[model samples]
Target: MYDGAIIMESLRVGTSLEAFPLILRRLSRYAVKTASADQPPVWTEFVFEVADEHAVELADALAEVLDQPGWYADFHNDEENFVIYPGRVFRYRRGDQLARAEAQEHGRTLGVPEPQLDWTD
Candidate 1:
């Protein structure tokens, strides 16, 4: 069974400090795997999972909520992941090392400094 699972690894949300609560509220419905917060700089990391079908909807929602100069989101799933800062998307298979390497190479070609080329559990 495929399970239609979408694991979001290292989902970094860059937004105004004031908007974090709202973003958290909006994503509360999903199953959060890990969440981290750092003071002084106020950076956060949210790792969550949702049905594969809902990935795009979630992305759109986040993009809308974090729409600002320094606001961006990075997501990693079985198919592809986005580096919003550079506006790049790379595709890779869940367990295929070769595909992941290729995707990373492709990302480099597109100017992504450090592409995530590993599978997320």
Candidate 2:
């Protein structure tokens, strides 16, 4: 299973994520507290599962929809990890520290806070 989580708040204006048929198998929602005035105090995260075969489609969709300003989506399967930012997607082996660092650095360059750059490997 390809498990991933997306914060509902991270979506860009006028953009809606598609509920890919037979791809998204499960979903869960949770609230995250934020102090920024630009965002709601409680942000809802939509955690989901997808079939591994749809990784490319998922990455492409996420790359297009994630906001350009520091927003990203992370998902992983048994052997690979995907880190997606607006207009960009990074694929790395499960345990590649170098690739992870590169992705994190890219996030930082996008003005993503260091804490927000934390994504499961």
Candidate 3:
């Protein structure tokens, strides 16, 4: 199984939420959380775990939908991490700091606040 979290508030208009309900169906567990951050104040997310098979679909959908400019979402399996930015997706080995830094730099350039770029592996 792969664990992932998608910020509900970061979704952009014109993108399909068709994947949302489908993702929930396979989830082993889930909960909603309002992120504790200062930039945008509170960003709510749906934290969940779905079968590994959903990773590709989830990444693609998130890339298409997440509002760019400091907004992103991520999920990971034991061996890999998938970070999705608007129209972009980055997959790197877990604990790979170099690869993680590249994704972070991209996020920074997109105007994502520094603190918001932190995603635990």
Candidate 3 lDDT over 1-121, as tens digits, reads: 7787776667875666674434442322233243334234555556777677777887887888888556888888899999889899999999999999999999878777777677877
Give the TM-score of each candidate. 0.37, 0.84, 0.79
Model 1, 12-48: lDDT tens digits are: 3453223222222122234322222211122234444
* Decoy 2 TM-score against native: 0.84
**TM-score: which candidate is best?**
2
Q: How are the candidates ranked when ordered by TM-score, highest leading?
A: 2, 3, 1
lDDT comparing candidate 1 with the true structure: 0.39
- Candidate 1 lDDT score at position 22: 23
Kindly give the stretch of ten consecutive residues in candidate 2 with the minimal lDDT sum.
31-40
- Residue 6, candidate 2: how far off, in angstroms? 0.6
Give one digit per residue, the lDDT tens place, for model 2 in 22-57. Answer: 344445455544323444456566677888778889
Candidate with the larger TM-score of 1 and 2 = 2
